[model samples]
Target: MFTTVRQQGWVDGSAAITGITPYASALECLMHYFREQQTICKKCCHVNYNHEAIQQCKLQKVDFIWVNRDLENFSWFLQLLNDFENEQLTYLETLRANNVTSKRYIDFHFYFTSLKSNNQGMIGYAPFDLAANIYQNVSNRDVLTKMRTKTILGRPQWSLLFAKFKAEHRRTSVFFTGKPVMGEDIKRWCDQYQFMYYHEPYF
Candidate 1:
C-alpha cells in the first residue's frame, strides 16, 4: 500500500488521512496515491494535478492512442470529415469575432516533414491491431503527420481538435482506456521521467 503525508488547512476543511489503506498490490497502491494527489491538488489549488504531475515526471515514453476497432470503416471517416467541417465553422466564427489572430498558413508539406523529423509527441492518429499493425501505424505517427500538415498549428487549436475528435469518435471509451499501464510500468515511467518516487513500508 501507500502512505502520504497529508497537507493540512485546506479550503474544504476535509479530514486528512491518518493511515494508509492496504492495497492488493504495489500498482494498486500507487494508482491510489496518484488519484489522491490529483484530488488534493485540484481541491486545494484548482490545478490539474495529474496532468502537471505527469508532465513534471517527464516520461519520454511514446504513449499510444488507440481508436476503436469497430470505427475503422469508411463511415467513421465520413463522420470525422463532418466533425472537421463543423470545427472549421467554429474556427471561422472565432476568427470573425476577432478573438483570435491570423497567421501565415503553411501547407501540408512543411507540417508532415516536421512531424517526421521531430521527436516530440504525436497528437492524433487512427488505431489498428497492435499485433498486426506496423510501429508507425499503431503508434499514430502517420496520422499525426497528416494532422500537423492539414490542421492549424497552434497548441490551443490542436488540443481542441484532439479533444473533439476523441470525444466524437469515442476513442477513449473504446481503445485508450482499455489498455491501462500496470503498477510496475507506472513506477518505471516515473523513474524514467525523474519524478519524485515514494513508497513507504507498513508499520
Candidate 2:
C-alpha cells in the first residue's frame, strides 16, 4: 500500500511514484540500501541520458525502471509495489490502445485520476514545489540550471515545470510553453490542469 496525504498544488493525480528526482537518484537510493556508498550514487550521474550512463548503471547491476503511477495500469501497478520488478514502458504503449477502448486513442485518464485522488499513494509533490520556488528566485539563470532542462528516466519529463508552479500557486497549474514542436504529453497535461502560459517551453 502507498501513503496518503498529498501536498497542495499540482494535478491531483500527478504523483511521484519514484521517491527520487531523476532516475539516477532512484537507482542511488537503491544502492544506498545495500552498498551504503554515498559517493557511488552521487558520482553515478548522467548527462542527457546517454548510452554510457546506462551501461555504467547496468554494470553495477542496477535496474533502470521508470515507475509512473497512473490509474491506467492496474496490472503494472501491482507489479511495481508488490512484485518489486520493472515494467517495460514500450509494452505498455502497445497494449494501451487495445485494452483502453474500442477506438485507438491516447489514454491520459490515468494521469488525470491520479492527480484528482485524495491519497497520492507513494507519490509526493515536494520536488516540483522546490523547483518552482527556485525558478522564481533564479529564472534568469542558465538553461541547465532551470527545471525543464533536467530529464527523468532518460527522457524529458515536462511535468517537472508545472510541479514547481503548483507548489507556489497552491493549485495544479500547467503551462503551455507555446512551442509548436512541444510534445502531445505536454499539451495534454496543460489542458487537464487548465493552464495557459506562453514561452519557449524550455528553461
Model 1 shows how many backbone clashes?
0
Query: Which tens-of-lDDT digit does each residue in 1-203 have in candidate 1?
Result: 11222100000001111112221132243334344544324456532233334334322111122122222232433243334334334434434565454321111111212112212344332232232135445553334322322321212122343344334332111111111222244335335433333332222
Q: Judge candidate 1 at residue 186 and give its lDDT.
A: 32
* Residue 80, model 2: Cα distance from true site in angstroms: 43
Cα-based TM-score, every candidate: 0.21, 0.20
For candidate 1, the lDDT comes to: 0.28
Q: Whole-model Cα lDDT per candidate?
A: 0.28, 0.31
Best by lDDT: 2
Q: Report the lDDT tens digits of candidate 2 across residue range 121-141.
A: 324655654564566567632
Model 1: how far is 169 from its true place, Å?
Answer: 24
TM-score of 2: 0.20
Cα error, candidate 1, residue 99 (Å): 7.8
| Clash totals for all candidate models | 0, 6
